[model samples]
Target: MWNLARVAWNLRQSRRLSFAIPPSISATQIDPSFFKRGLPFTTCKGFSTLETQESGGLIPSELLTKKTVLRPDRDIGQYADLVTRVTNFHGEDKGFMVLAGDVFDVPIRKDIIHRVVRWQLAKRQQGTHSTKTISEVSGTGRKPYRQKGTGRARHGTLRGPQFRHGAIMHGPKPRSHAIKLQKKVRRLGLKIALSARTAEGKLIVFEDLALPSHKTKNIVNYVTQMENTKKVLLVDGGPIDDKLKLATRNLHYVNVLPSIGLNVYSILLHDVLVMTQDAVNRIVERMHTPINR
Candidate 1:
């Protein structure tokens, strides 16, 4: 009877322990905020509190201002100084002056430019072909002279290795001549190139490049004063200036292009680049964006 009583007491203790959940571990289960409303996590904005927790925090939005007015009274010389320092080119050290109010501020990617030019040059081939062996050539059904003594050299088929116009052996086949550069590195290279160009007085900026009519001579004269050279690339921010377009149309070395059409090839090909202040501002805005973060 005493043994039965003890077993019943132990059974009741085990039941009580099993029914009670520990307080310390309870907090780790369902979050208490799940029951709440109107919080940032519970709000119906497509994002859930659970997601926020998973991602480690709220993702900050990129801040952009539409009304970023550019400083017209810019020191082009100072701007060129910055570019020279960044690109590590000797243009600034050489005492090259950058004229303000021109489209001379161009972004460069030196590494990318170097790689691209090198790739282009490496693609050139010597155009040499190989010679084919006797076994691979056609018309070798029978031996000309039984491998042994034939007063004349034991000649095989006409299409043999010794004959002209035979198939080539161990020749170069079509393959990719491209060198792979990382995306980040390529972008940096372009920036460096632009910086170098800016330091070199290659980027030109203008208030406006268009005219009322197509006066090629007027455009040439204007560019000659600004660039002091016939070779110039006139880059505009918006629509083409009709007057500037007409003026440079006949000039062989002058090319008037839109800002959106700018490329590494076009930027590097010209002796000088002329741009409007607005274009420079746009470039600065683009470069200073919070992308580096």
Candidate 2:
């Protein structure tokens, strides 16, 4: 009887001990709401909260904290009254202002720009590629064999596509790849290019490109001091000065073009645009003129 009583007491103590120990949490015991909040009180070992969020098909909150900020576009009306300061060849302030409204007020048109660039690139192509046709080939016009005699396939001439050294079939021929765009469209594209440069603060206006000597070192030293980058395009109102041309010719990154030569392609290609005040006036006037057709 005593043994039975002791066994009952032992069993009760074992039951108490089992209840005192906490139950281990299994994967199924986790609340689904914790996942919806993107965090859980208990996480698996060797994993982080961010990793948990990522594994749940959600972007990590920390990654989305930093964002790309863009500058606000300048007002069109403000450009009309805009006056840019002019600097001299020696980088000294000339204390003169040039009206930049007409050139800087234009809104950027990406589609028109793309079309103009494509057109300019197309016009530059020489299109000199040539291929001879059957008529141009050296082979005689006579047929290779009779209509149908042997088991071999019939051929009209040796110049046909099958024969070696024969004329090419549907090959490229010499022709112009030039593409024409409307004058107004071209003008607008130029304005937009200028405006883009202005907005980006890459346009520089100078009194003139006139230099004392034709030495390359003079212009190179001047440009190196004034420009932040080596890629610069100089625009002059009239014919480029002989000294300036010679000075800039040796430098691959520097280009000199008359105002008339100013196009979207050259403008966009350069990192900096340095133009004379007269050149700026010419561009504004050109943009103001109405296209004939």
Candidate 3:
């Protein structure tokens, strides 16, 4: 009887112990907040909250939908100084002057610049590619085989794609690749390009560009006086001086263009832009002109 009583007591103790201890939970199954709080519980091995958070930080949804403005001028200044100088054919400095607020101080428009460049490049393409089609080929129109008598498959003209020396299929033809752009867009592009050059301190203004003689050495000597100039694109307001043209023609690094020929492509192509006072005035006037529509 005593031995039966001891076994019953031991059974009750075992049941109480089973109810006191809770079942083990996996780290993944535990609530994330539980780990944030100092809970005295062991998590499953190889699971970490720090690892997941460190992999990628929380990104706001609004940031993903935000668009970048091509011409953002929140803190850009309104006016800039124009460095001006007059030099003779011998590169001697005749006079120095500072023109204030000469170049336009507008925000840079990268998109407009890109479009203008693409349009200019497109217009330059000759697009003279040509190919002969089946109809234009010089093959005879006679049929090669009979319809019913021959065991071989029936054949048509020799100009067919299956035959040798066949006409090109869907080949290119001559056409113009010029892209028409709006006048306002082109104007804006030029302004942005000029502004960009001025902002980078690459714009140089001259009182005038004239040469006494057509000697290339004289022009080279004059250009060598300009500091930090690698490749030069010289622009004049009116007709290009004949002497200047002849002097710059042989120069591989120097290009001469009239004020009317100043475009975004040519402006951005060269490292340094050398413009005469007349050219700058004409450009500013052209840019200020209101479009009809």
Candidate 4:
């Protein structure tokens, strides 16, 4: 009798222990590397260790570290100044200028640049394209012939799909093609473009873009001094001066814009970016401003 009771008690204890553990961890073997990476470890109810916990597959190699580890701006002490020569309109070196590393040293990303350029182009489109439909077409509504009497194919209105000069079917209409992109993404794209120019050694800083006169000939002389650059973009801190704008108006290869008007598309269009000292300060301040959600 004593032996039989002892056996029954052992069986009940085993069942209780089995029911205590949930199915998720009952047979799961934890990945050893999970703890090495400093990831949080949890085994509470409703919490899962991994997607393939049942089979105990090793953690993906990508999950070993943070994704932003490769970016150059990861360290606070690494924000080195980008020193470049500041020249006057006559192409004479005036002094040296220090540019913010955060803005001009960003890593280049082609996908983001492409996306922002596309977004800017799409937003600026006129969206005026249109086509007339069957009801709107100018034509007689009467059928061409009876439905079954003629041996030729029966016809409806002259503006039908099969007839010449007919209305277009399911054609494109006037609409917006602008896609929604995050403000952070737009800002980042601009930074990347600037960085790319810097990386290519094409960034030029000017002490001042103030032209002595609005004569196109004088501007041409100044441009020729800069190694005969083909495309030039001149940027000022605030509203462009009347003299400068008028002087460059005739030069199709030269464009002038205020710092506020700067954009990624414009930056990439030109071979060189010329900016005043004041413009660089304004740009750096603008980039550092906090963005609100």
Models sorted by lDDT, best on top: 4, 2, 3, 1
Residue pairs that clash (backbone atoms under 3 angstroms), model 2: none
The most accurate candidate by lDDT is 4
- Model 4 lDDT-worst window of ten: 62-71
After superposition on all C-alphas, the RMSD of every candidate to the true structure, in Å, is 20.7, 16.1, 17.5, 14.3
lDDT string, candidate 4, 135-249, tens digits: 8789899988899967988787899867889999997789987888899899999888888888767788988888788989877886777664788899999999999989999
Q: Sorted by TM-score, highest first, which candidate order results?
A: 2, 4, 3, 1
lDDT of 2 at 46: 34
Provide the overall lDDT of each model, using Cα atoms, as 2-decimal numbers.
Answer: 0.53, 0.78, 0.74, 0.80
Q: How well is each residue in 70-177 modelled by candidate 2, as lDDT tens digits?
A: 334555424564667798778788976656676776777899899999999999999999999889999689988888978788888998778999989999999999
Over the full model, what C-alpha lDDT does candidate 3 score relative to the true structure?
0.74
Error at 61, model 1, angstroms: 63
On TM-score, the stronger of 1 and 3 is 3
Give the backbone clash total of model 1: 33
User: Residue 41 of model 1: what lDDT?
Assistant: 32
Measured by C-alpha RMSD in angstroms, how accurate is candidate 3?
17.5
In candidate 4, list every pair of residues with a backbone clash: none
Between candidates 1 and 3, which one is better according to lDDT?
3
- List the candidates' TM-scores in order: 0.45, 0.73, 0.67, 0.70
- Compared with the true structure, what per-residue lDDT tens digits does model 3 show for residues 113-200? 9999999999999999999899998979988777778788877878987778988899999999999999988887888888888776
